[model samples]
Target: MKKNLFIGALTLTAAPIFAQQAVQRPNIIFIMSDDHASQAISAYGHPLSKLAPTPNIDRIAKNGAQFWNNYCANSLSGPSRASILTGKHSHKNGYLANWNKEFDGSQQTLPKILQENGYETAIIGKWHLISEPTGFDHWMILDGQGDYNNPDFITDNDTVQYFGYVTDLITTFTKQWLQTRDRDRPFFLMMHHKAPHRNWVPAERHYNLYEETEFPVPENYFDEYEGRFAAKNQEMNIYRDMYEGHDLKMVTGIDSDTLLFDPWPDAFINTLTPYEKKRFFEAYRSRNNDYYNTDLTEKEIALWKLQRYLQDYLATIKSVDESVGQILDFLEQSGLDENTIVIYTSDQGFYTGEHGWFDKRFMYEESFQMPMVMQFKGEIKPGTQVHGLTQNIDFAPTFLDFCGIKIPEDMQGESFREMVVSGSTPEDWRQSLYYHYYEYPGIHSVRAHYGVKTDRYKLIYFYDEDIWELFDLENDPTEMKNIFGEEGKENITEELKKELSRLQKLYEVPGI
Candidate 1:
């Protein structure tokens, strides 16, 4: 009888251990928003955030950690996404620009690593990097800069046009994949949204949101580019020179005599409504009257222009927020919420009249910082906040690490899993971040600049112009003043320059 009791006790002890071993591996869902600025999310505390509340994005912050200081390797879409995929910089991936570049999928990527480790991988929505997605077992991607409405999707089967909002279609595909994917194995899914980019057009449902509200102007909305040569030539300003080129098919309500030649064909005029038609003609007529014929006031035309721009831009963001909500709902209904890791971020930051600029590619805080948040459900403690410097390249390795997969030795990024899952902050953390913006004199008048941003100061070097711009971030957070050549700050500038040089050498930057 004593022998029987001993065997029964052993069986009881082993039961829980067996149950633990039977638990399934977690799912990973990564979502990306194009040109989404950190300031746009209420969780980040921008003054103008009340204009459009991102409750769904804030939901992730409430359920997980909101990374306060996350930045991108290169502040552009293709390069930043490439950095996240390959765990390398633009120089390594060889995709530095939006035009005529192809991404090589042979490189080690998080998805491929996960797939090798028994995880099923799928990607839907924008895959701007010029290559067939490699690591993914399944993928349905937009050709490039996907249309906001009735977007074209290249699936594993064929290229098909889906007649709906881009965000909705992408979310729908993600949900359908989740429903039909192999349930036995874990999965990694990327749902990338193409909304909120240029020519911001929302779905029919989000057309009139924030329509009655007037967005407050940013403090530096009228930046004069004083003390900074690079800022003087940016092509992102909305007022004076922010017209869409021939490629984008923009129909401004302004008159022909005062406007530059239309880059679009006459067929585009058919899309205008009777009221829109009246406004378009009046704008051109007013421009001709004010400048060429002398009739209407400049102030009237400026007000009209602001109204037209805001209507389209805010509408796009509304659709993005709605789509985020839909994905969250799917997670909850599928019983995958408790075991899934959800990440929401953007390729780069964008300007909404910040510094009177409307695009990214600058080291300025608005364009440099990106919105990043992650929710690992029960695995990570909710409402956690991390202030450590996180880069875009870190994403690939972090995902690999979470799945217990081996990160490729060629990947330069370090996993932030310790900081995220264990809440352990490292002592040897980086004191500064290195940034490089190569696209210059193309879209934004931003010059090619490389810089190092510390907690208190920022030093930027414009290589072609042989110019250095330094800002005491603690004193002048707005970056209005350049103190690189100022008296008494010479030592600080010199030290920062050395630090910058050290980082460039450490990163093996060739031209620096």
Candidate 2:
């Protein structure tokens, strides 16, 4: 088995803030889930809002502000995570893709900066950066693409397999760590969860949730990919790309050796102990049997997969919601709520059959946008919402800002602390957001591309394919029609290109 473990020396920076201030510093708990889409959370009010609601995640919105225009600098897990950690784009951070790349732990990161400035820092759960975690006092994480049930965790001491659902196990470790952490000093905790990722395994308790619920198929679920070449070329289409026995978790009896198509790996299931395997396999036996016994047309199969996909995906999220509620309850009961900054977000947005897709890579809204909510009791106004464009790059700076620490000059993202405190958009805030994705010759076959998204329009360039696509988001929110060369769109296209060029230069990224 390939090991994804990195251990490094711990370096402490000067405790600049602690030396200057006598006031109590705020405690921060950033909770992130893997591949969680905005539409899946009811707080975003997407098409599936009514069918599956996230009450616990909504609590953060109800109590604080919900950022509707939040996004990831890069849609892939490792790249986005690297951006969040170092407050720089993938190019500067040197973690451009998920596979065969490890984060440069020697570089300054949020946890390191905070730890240097007199805050106790710890991270538990999915740390996919692939480097020995540095700057943290305590850190525990799962191996790459951790299993959903009874996952193994890598800590500073050793790798141990914990019994229970992965989501529940992550929360258990988080709570346990919080309970024993130094209470006198303020601390920062990254409680990351690996739920709702690929394979979409739910806890046995939530296995049946949404099973009877039929999801509203996205309007573009059967997208013909009329204009965009990249969309047409992707390997993530719902009907053609998703694997039967793996992605949908249906037990297709076709032997890998006999079948022409490659089989999904059962390594995750193989990791389970005898009893764990028995209970888990038995729970899905009837469902798998039912799926294999049925026959359907292409469209029917697509719709069936959509339903199955959402049920399992949302069921996993249900556990994450419960975990959020448990954390909130702990904060309130322990009096930490009064001074803590609680944030709920995801690594990146995912596609729930949007544009006939199941993964995130495209510059489309469904894949590029992320769900973010933050509550800082008595500091930020309750029920406030911000429409300003924020990216994952801003996270590190924002945390440093809240701690009253001077953000490092090399950090590329600006802190949104002022806007959160004022409950209004800053007059000088950015008007357009820049995005780039580069993992080609990689999975899903999403070509390397970059784009800029403004409130009214978007322009993407598939540099490798040398194709330009533009959309008037105000009119074509689904982005079904590409209007790059349309007669009246020339000026808008030119304007977007100008902004994109400026952003690339400003961020020091390679120009188009």
Residue range 377-467, candidate 1, lDDT tens digits: 7778988888888888889888878777777887877889888876656888678888888886566667888899987899999999999
lDDT of 2 by residue, 1-512 (tens): 12312211111124435433523689899999999999989988876856888999999999999999999998999998889989999888988888745788998899888988878899999988777789899999998777777778998889998877889988998999989987546899999999889878888888777878989998889898999999999999878888775677666452211112326454456656777657766676665666657787777878998998889899999999999999999999999899899999999999998888998988899889999999998889999898888999999999999988999999999899988878888999999999999999799999999999999899999998999999888889989999999998888988999999999999999544
CA displacement after TM-score superposition, residue 371 of candidate 1 (Å): 0.6
Cα displacement (Å) at residue 118, model 1: 1.0
Candidate 1 least-lDDT 10 residues: 245-254
Model 1 clashes, total count: 7
Which one is best on lDDT? 2
Weakest 10 consecutive residues, lDDT, candidate 2?
4-13
Write down the TM-score of every candidate: 0.86, 0.93
Query: Model-by-model lDDT, in order?
Result: 0.77, 0.86
